[model samples]
Target chain A: MTKVKDIGEQGLLERLQRFCPPDVIGDDAAVLVTDPEQSLVVTTDMLVDGVHFSNATTSPEDAGWRAAAANLSDLAAMGATPLGITVALGLPGDLSVNWVESLYQGMTECLQQYHTPIVGGDVVRSPITSLSITAFGQVHPNRIIRRGAAQVGDAIVVTGVHGASHAGLKLLLDPQIGKHLTTTEQAALIKAHQRPQPRLDVLPHLWKILDNSKFKIQNSKLRINNSPSPQSPVPSPQSLTPVAGMDSSDGLADAVLQICRASGVGAVLESSQIPLPTAFDHWLTSEQALNYALYGGEDFELVLCLPPEAAKTLVQQLGQDAAIIGSITSDTKVLLHHQNQKIPDQVLNLSQGFQHFSP
Target chain B: MTKVKDIGEQGLLERLQRFCPPDVIGDDAAVLVTDPEQSLVVTTDMLVDGVHFSNATTSPEDAGWRAAAANLSDLAAMGATPLGITVALGLPGDLSVNWVESLYQGMTECLQQYHTPIVGGDVVRSPITSLSITAFGQVHPNRIIRRGAAQVGDAIVVTGVHGASHAGLKLLLDPQIGKHLTTTEQAALIKAHQRPQPRLDVLPHLWKILDNSKFKIQNSKLRINNSPSPQSPVPSPQSLTPVAGMDSSDGLADAVLQICRASGVGAVLESSQIPLPTAFDHWLTSEQALNYALYGGEDFELVLCLPPEAAKTLVQQLGQDAAIIGSITSDTKVLLHHQNQKIPDQVLNLSQGFQHFSP
Candidate 1:
């Protein structure tokens, strides 16, 4: 019957620290001793209750899972290996201890599965509930993927299904729309929205392609040399690296534009080439489905550019779930290329995200 | 004038990056290549509007100063050196670009003055404006300080003024409280509340003291036999170390209670030994002034345990600015002694802080 307030902030921290791994909490700051050769990668993301998740519709566990996943996905996009995560939570006084504990449990589920430890954190009294997670990771100098390295002739590739989370979000927000889907279908969509996976497993292949591409002028040379030689240290024959990459948090089109803007190149995305959610046709019109695939956001899928052969090999190794979505170009404009002629329309729309300060 | 919405999230980041120095703001995460000899020390803190600071009473710069100082004080408590910081901001729309820019300027003034780079960050749209900062530091394993290391015989030392900020907060909330004070006194109190300087500079002296103390925890076992021998290296004749440590973010009594709980030791605080602002007596009784010194928070001053000789040396080195306020004891309760008697009452109240989840 101990309320968080009853014990006080320090008491609550002591209680939480009892369950957390020893040496991680109860210090001014957690200490991490890492490999000297590796570079530390850090990314931060903030999730506000009403903005990122609806407390009425989502459990604390789900909210925690989603927030951690968002930052983890950023690391995965950079081909970085997870190290530790530091969280800062601002909470309302009325929140239950059970809710906060469940939230930590959800974050631990994802972070532990990936070997990322929860190191240290701060909790403050806030009128509105909010959490900010700063995730630490490590990536080899040469293996680090950037959004600006795509070449003009490289092929665009993406992993996993796109827009399922968007579909799931719509269903979660509107039970009326979800009523049309089968119970199993509804559950799958809801799961996508609640627990999108970070693509930590796909880094090896992505790094290989980048190593082979050898744009050494723009990149720090990796420990592995991928030049044509008997000693050529290609990680795997099927595991190819991409020229450039980023995660699709703001949908495929927006991610592509980010790559283009960074690389000083344009892109040509084929609508037919994109792998949309299987239940898209059952839920909406073709245009709406396309919109979701191109600009719906929160897929957590990495989008990268590879040589045609390397892209094909990557797709083959990653299975039918991964596919070639498009190609890089010199036009400096991102265009949606459907059947035959170019669609002459911007692939990414300005109205895609839950714009925080929308007028 | 370009509103933040015009650039959108990505565009605003780009605009900010233009002035934020190269390699600080463009990546998914910044890569920190640090010295291998030191351990990575990380701490995170968040400031919420209406919770930590108010848009009505506080300027963005003052809010920035307090937030940065809080995290910096934590690092200083551990005798760690500042490395860099990553910020995650959650902002409502209709917030002026000018306001946000000024906020950054304030943060930059503090961080840059300390040579701690503003490394990487994320900006998100939220219904309420808030900011979370994760700061990185490095500390030597041999010199690492902990709150639980206080010994029974040690002088409790603290740097800088106390209760001034609390008085300043009171004045900020209600201007009428300042009517009796001279303009100089009012300005001093207001400045104390607005800008609590982080004690990062005091770290060198602390580390030297700890190194001299040479409890020889791990490395000593590796080198020194710890038995009476000529081979044993006791560091210095004059430079001595404190027994344990922490910063006073939550006032002296609470901090003393925390050290007691952590170290399984108690403390004896003589009211006569306590220091107060000179103007305090003119405005309030001696009891009220003592209460403010013992219970007022956010001083960002360090409260550490030291030997009498070392405390003298520190006071001499730091001038009259540093004071030996109390001592550690075998008794397992914190006692506030006045004249010759220990006050038989709770030294600290549980309801003191801005307790979140309070019923």
Candidate 2:
């Protein structure tokens, strides 16, 4: 009798994927082809009381915002525009009504930012608080991004700096860590951990850059291939190659590895090119900062794979907001590039990300 | 300073409804008009350990079946056929892998019966296990049923006998409850509770009956009133009066009250006409059976409202599967009728259904 701990979260997910339908569990969000022209993308994430957040550290409002952002970030990763969401909450009986209301306020405020509404929900009593949010979005079927679509020679791009959230989490959990920082710096780091903004605003730029040339070709091909069957016009992976994408909720390294594994390719991450927030300079060593930048989770930033030209265009257009930190490889190993080293870089550290079941 | 226990589940939902968008939280499922021809109905239900189910009373397989059935029942209430569902799970690490696999097997089996697939999911670690399922379904926009559409003079109808599931739960929790019943009778009742079926098969008959008369008028009106705007063709409540509906997960009496409140109408339940399974005869009195029939939650049956003619047609088509339990009234009160020597019925007992936060 194997316990869930023995197999861990990844093993459990693999078990589910084997049991589920082929197209169901592999993507950032499940794509349901609603029509020939459009597809519906749906994703769900569950946050537990002790596992994801604690009352001592996260305010009810912040918890609500973070939960909403997590789901919204998934939609963004799939290149889908917001529609609405359903929230199912399990709360303790002793929780104050004010706390619940404040939580709603946070969720609503975050959702409103992206023009998404809370469409439906169920509330039940439990010993510990937990929130499960399911977000729905719509995208042109040809334009939907996937984790398995990273082509060889594609540039690996990431949005925003990392590690601030993890640092903030550390600071919140340990007051001694805050002693070295100024009050303003401490407040900024704490805020980063408390309120993560889903990179929904960057989606339009991503689509505009990737969808322009490839999408027009796919559109013409679709028109030529249109048949009586509704799903016949849906472009296949070979017909329209999308940028591999997912949000960095489970740490940057894990996000990249997931894409590589899904796409059956390798990656070369330039250690010097990876973005670390300036806040890390206040106290952390260069190596410590790099480690946090690579493996610290809950960034809520976009990780994208695109052709070099498209990546260049994205970086040129977005300027400081985006970075091309690596490139896809034919080899089936994720490696890192040392700035002054020759030929090869060591295989990237396997000790990465926060696994839910890891001791 | 108010606690969730003070307000209870209903009160918390009311609070959510007040804060959510007008069209968001009012129905068994929120209907999103995707195209002029179709609407997408989405509903979510969360089941928690100790609160909704216990390992002592329920197998993981049964828990999965119950959770899936609960969401499927919501889709049925809205006259929507399921498309797919996303399950977000929170499990404790010490749980056996077999238990988790069995849970998925039960969910998949139940979903497969209705051709609904598991499309997406997320799993996380938690102190207490919980399952949150969000179900997606589709229906013809004009034909979609609503909770707030019961008109005065409409007949109140119910599907299948009630109280069996609640009795089954009692038997599972307390072995003494089975003392008077034969083995077959006990098994039947226990099965009823563990594996309640969603009334999806009866939906076609319902649509065939109700849509034949009212739908034609509404469809013709829609064509004549079709405007350049896409949403303009969506029929208003005045244009198409659908049969008010919901599942009996929260007890028959509570279901009746919800519809009555939503539709701004009163109801008269004929006490003698309410259906109860024959298993009740083995151990329970007539009064006890009636209480269980009216107030026993988790039946997963349908409570419907229709014009007397339509109701008659439905009963004629469904036979024993459905029964005319009562009628809608203009007065704003829900009452129970006595079969003999009664000009007026008494107000229904307010003590009904399972309230999640109540002591």
Query: What are the iRMS values of all candidates?
Result: 17.5, 0.9
What is the alpha-carbon lDDT for the whole of candidate 2? Answer: 0.82
Give the CAPRI class of candidate 1: incorrect
Candidate 1 collision pairs? A93-B356, A93-B357, A142-A222, A206-A241, A208-A241, A209-A240, A209-A241, A210-A241, A357-B93, B155-B306
Error at B225, model 2, angstroms: 17
lDDT of each: 0.68, 0.82
**How accurate locally is residue B176 in candidate 2, as Cα lDDT from 0 to 100?**
91
Give me the candidate number with maximum lDDT.
2
Off by over 4 Å in 2: A175-186, A214-241, A340-344, A352-359, B175-180, B214-241, B281-283, B341-344, B349-359
Give the alpha carbon lDDT tens digit for every residue of A283-357 in model 2: 897667766777888898899988778888877777765799999999888887768545456576456432321
TM-score of chain B of each: 0.78, 0.90
| Candidate 1 deviant stretches above 4 angstroms | A1-36, A174-183, A208-242, A281-286, A307-310, A339-359, B1-36, B174-181, B213-243, B281-283, B307-309, B339-359
